[model samples]
Target: MYDHTKQYRCTIIRGKSKKEMDDFLPVYAKVIDEICPCSESEFESLFNNAFIRFLPESDRIKKTMDNHRTEIAGKLFGMYYRADDGIVYESERTQKFLEDNDQPAFFKDICYKMQFPNGTQKVGTTVRQRVADGICIRPIAFVLKVLLIAKQANVFITKREIGYYILNSLDVLQGNASPYEVFEQIVKDQKDGTERTIIVPGKATSYNWQHIKEQLNYLELANLIRFTDDKRVVLNLNELQTIELFAADYDKKPEFDVYSYDLSSLDGRKVFQLDWDYYFSQISAVSDQFATSAEALLFDGTVKDEQKSEGKPKPAVNLTAFGDEGESIVYEYEKKRVSEFNTRLANKVLSLGRTKGIGYDIQSVIAEPGDMAEFVKYIEVKSTKRLTCPDMNDDLWVDTLNVTRNEWIAAQQHGKFYSIFRVYFTRDGIFMFVIANVAEKLNDGRMTAVPMTYRVDFNKSSVDSVIVPQS
Candidate 1:
């Protein structure tokens, strides 16, 4: 999705304020559901009137009964599945947004393509036009990743540094290219060879260094970042406590090397459906970790979350972080449970996630209060971050889980001693469900397993090697 050789510029889509969007998008979707196959003008009229009803009794609103169809679609066109015949339809993302009704999910979709090389807005085009392209590189994700990395290294980064070099180049944004290293090169181009405001123009790299910063200003709604007195960009840890959520250790690996696809020919909804399902799967508000509070999301310049999730605060995150966190959460849970019975067994609770070929993540033992330990149990942790907490709400929910070939084999070999701890991350907290004796369950028709992925091999021995004279 990222071209290392190409340079990309940031695009801004400030078609509406945060609250306007929070109010309008859902209403737009509702109108569509209420009347499908509606004309563009019809949608515009209904959506405008419906949304206007939600506003307060203000003179400004009363004075100007605006037609915001163009403005609304400018920023959020990617969420629409419209027809060339001027009709609109319900999209998968629209359904997901309605399914998980909130400002965070709404803004989450927005942020996924808020930055450069985005689909919702044009990139490197004459018309850096809002709602023009069909590509979503998520430079914000890359930018966030860079900031998180620099934070760990105690590196103070300025907005210009991020905008000029990092966001401008796909190499730094999507490849292993370092922002500091690229900045160092930029310094070489400078007459001062360091930070300065010396005038230098006519060169391709010397003008408009703060282009992306304009778009960065729009991220105030998310409220995930702050600027220092020196204009350095920093995570808003002091106010939001979002530092832990963006921890560098959470997702240690980089996602630079991913399969590439072009959807410029497709519509916004189709592009979003594919990207939402695959590209931004774990990175968006769909994951509890990535989700911000309602206040941060729907920021009117000031607000914080009133209702925080209870229990150990394990925020849903990327897949790697999700697994690591799930294992740790289960490990702690096991330790605490065992400590109630036998402190010694609790101390012995082991995290085997790093241990190779274990086919499991954690290890514990079944025991009674009086050190009545029965046998050791191998735990395989399967984790997923969802829109809702089935445990918290007592709602019956089940998702198809992919079990590795090694894990299935371990479940079979370990018999009754094996347990699968299913951990689900919601905005509330992580909920775990234990399924013990998986082999027996599968044998007795209680459960079934299917092959998800496999490695294919040819029987070379059967097809004997040709022994021909050397050419």
Candidate 2:
């Protein structure tokens, strides 16, 4: 797991130790000798091609090279050719990859630190502090690009097709050359000035298709697109309109650059940077929180019949005056019962049943794993007397349930800390069903959302329902 708290402490140093240099320099020299075998004076050109070819065609590598191309290119130039300049560079993405892959650590234990002729210390260059700072590709930006591509083609695109389109387009914009042509140039540029030519080991590819599929799934989670059963995707027209408006406002900003590559270029207009923060803010406002599953309320036994004692006289009450009051009492009773259940688990529960506009019905704090900290849990309790009875003939039979807009919105905001508690009043006892992080489950397609009220739609999907049985 990526520790957000410890990210700042873990950094790369500029210079390499003697042992590191000894180990890495030979590998670098071997690659260069095979590729270019240039004289020491032309080592810079030889080293650049070697280093560029060394990068794997992975998503992380693509992101790193995209953001730090100049820095990376400069470091190679100084490392092999201009020894007087020294070499020091650090980036979080690269450092993390090296650590994970057990590659040589960067910016640690320097054997010798270089100094400039002016007596200035030549420390290593730290790329932008946060990954977000150097982020050129964002999920929303990809979403916009995918939508534009679909619009241009006037057809639904498969995830694979979208991946190919993005990969090809990115190669042109970033590399300023075709994939194969770039690969050929790298090999050709590294000629040894002899009859012999270096043989490139692998085929050149722009991007990995799997990574693009993952990106598509993220867009689906953000509700930017919808997927068909056949894995084809259609742009969410509503989301596209909102994004277009966002693009329009972004274009009016003073900081907007016309020369940048952006999705706006699809319409032959001047490009402008998309406002990531603003786009997310809009998504947050409309997205709803999670809801409970219908299967959680299922019970085995049939509804119990009310039996009257023999020869016992029944007292009748006025249905007109006390009817509303009686219903209110039942409603409060169910809420109190659910609250007590949560309280028994050692969680501090606060009832917001009477508190208007709070969205959730209860607020509680529960200890996280390893007892590191406490997290506030927002719960929207839904009570019903109905039970999901299984039909012997049809396997698809299920109980239908409704979740209001306010409740759903709360789930979206709280995310992991949000849950839906279904308290079912049965003839024998009350049954409790807990569905945590309902919005995330919905986003993952474990649950589906419909208009008016969020529906579990058990008939359409399998439910991983967990029930807390009455003791």
Candidate 3:
């Protein structure tokens, strides 16, 4: 119960009766239109005006210079908007998702850190100090654990229960300790000759209950939990199935990053970049954290591919059945993604895997909302089959990838239109990491490319004529 590993806590920005997490998209869309085409340095000043302009006149006066106002902007923008090529814009189609399903966006993005642009220098203080000082906590983790805790009693949990048990007390959040074992452990509260004493949940001292109520309001707005008739919290029955998906992973830790987070802060554009990348890394874990219910991820036609051998003990993959199932999976996923824009474009998506020299494996299109119909996309698929599914924390689980000289050249040629869709074959499902504009990462000195193998050709005729022999 006293383990330091499980003692994580959250520090959500608080304001009275602020239920505005759902307003993220409309504000972002409006802010991007007002401030984009401006340099990355000009973002904050411009964002200040746009953000202030969006708030009600009465609220605007109080928040024009408020840090809470900017903090909320960081969280909202970090989740959905980003700065690319010196422009701030919305990356996720959360507005569309809500329009299609009548619900809020996913909660994972806001719960974790974000990635930066192709090139960013100094770090910023907004998100870094929060982590180093032990101020950062994933809100989703609390939502799940509190619901799980409440399941023990088949009743709603009040603010004091959460404040006493989870928010303040720490048995380290991950364990299977029975109710009796947990409450029984003590720190010798009264010892003339005593071994241990009880720590009552009722005598719970909740210092941060007011702040917790603020977060609960946001989580509730995200459709994460339900408020009972008396305004207490409980887990929705369907959320239990979603909770099952997280049986393996619930906490979004900040352990994995190829870059050095030892610095005090992060770059401005890089802040949004990191936020976007963090969100991308999460899609592989749960089918869809943004789903209205738990069953949104579908396995329509894809099946787990297994290797078969004919009484042999030499190799692992059955050579007779050696095939590009991963590529097939990627091709289908890309097609489905494009179909959201237009069926005609999705039908036009082609598998160019058979043609080796082209570098890219598939051809597709990318479309921004309220923009042009579509732009041709060049996609290179790099795939690996993991024998055991690896953890996708803040770090890149599938870190290194093999890129042919030809593929690198293709990435250089197509630039923004090019993407490397990293496809991972696991027993659970096919997971992917969409890396766009590889050339920019190379040019900006953000990503490195190392030469591993060399190719050479020889001609006998040329050797005899052009070469001189030494005795």
Candidate 4:
């Protein structure tokens, strides 16, 4: 009798007659049913109820059982099988497929390329490659496919609720105890650990559960860590965190805040710049001269006398002090006004340069000194005396320096992301700089003045890196 206890190499028997291979269907059926479940008892019960092994004797009897096994595995586990005389086959799950020696050479090559470069190119490319190489029938469009699978956690719920479950579960899973114990501990920890009764730890790194639940639920479903009783709930802690190998020490590490924001508020969504395109479009439609020439830039002076005298249409620009000024003085004012408008638009353009990658947060920015976190340049306009830069600790001073060398080095080693520029802006064509590099002077009440019309220049020693666009 064949020693069936030994691991099947799946090669020598590849050429066996259909009747010979059909004899092993019972063994394959038993193992598949067993390993599929989390506990042995559950698998045993499921296996016995679902299948009946036939005595291997006549080829007719063997072929009949082989077809039944294929159909059963397919329906139960999304498996498929093909037969050559009496032999049966089915596609294995990814984890099982890796260890299977009998896997087709084509599948083996696909696995090699999928895990190529040791997973560096794994992100955003796996599913596409699988399809392009004909490994899978269709392409997986996003990087989230792997994250979904790893979560072994299937089932979908609202992003907000799912987020709550993952987070609440994560809280419970920490500390020295079984995950079951972690749940009760979290409820206790939340009530007492913080000064506040409701311990709402700041924000997550990228998502807000309320806003992104559908996408998140998709992830939970593919991983198979989903709860059966509460189908909407997430149950797998190890899968949720995407940690393949769990170490007790890893659970002890410090957690960082995730970036999240509510942009619905007026203050949060305020457009700092008015639409100049609309204004120009209106001007262009008025006349050919205005459209083609600089005539559109002219300010209406005729309305000042009639409009000011008759209180009908208000003069285009208000003047607190314009007593009997000559054409030269008026020309200068008009030019200055246009320049000011352009400068304001330029400042707004600079503000858009800030995003999550650059680590600009509305909460932190609103907390910065002097309401000037976005102020890259500052100008002190004095009518009579020349504007002098204040002392290092002066109230009106702004720092336009980057993070200091020592602080930057420390941040590079220990920080999750660099704090490159917490402050930089321009006001009235004067530049103010409070960069992350000036960590020493950040808290100090120091001020400096510099030119506003400056641009970054690159030399051999001072080269600027390429900027990547966010999708």
Indicate which candidate wins on TM-score. Answer: 3
Q: Would you give me the overall lDDT of model 4?
A: 0.26
* Candidate numbers, best lDDT first, in rank order: 1, 3, 2, 4
Error of 1 at 310 (Å): 22
What do the candidate models score in CA lDDT, each in turn?
A: 0.52, 0.36, 0.47, 0.26
**Preferred candidate (TM-score higher): 1 or 2:** 1
Cand. 3 Cα-lDDT: 0.47
Clashes of each: 1, 7, 13, 46
**In candidate 2, which residue ranges exceed 4 Å CA deviation?**
1-153, 175-207, 238-241, 245-432, 435-471
* lDDT, candidate 2, 358-431, per-residue tens: 77777766544445234567777655432221223532222224566777788898898888765543223455
TM-score of each: 0.42, 0.26, 0.43, 0.16
The digit string of per-residue lDDT tens for model 3 on 406-454 reads 8988998999889987664432465787888999988897666666457
Residue 222 lDDT in candidate 1: 46
Q: Which portions of model 4 show Cα errors greater than 4 Å?
A: 1-67, 74-223, 228-230, 240-471
Q: How far is candidate 2 from the true structure (C-alpha RMSD, Å)?
A: 27.0
Worst 10 residues of 3 by lDDT: 298-307
For candidate 2, the TM-score is 0.26
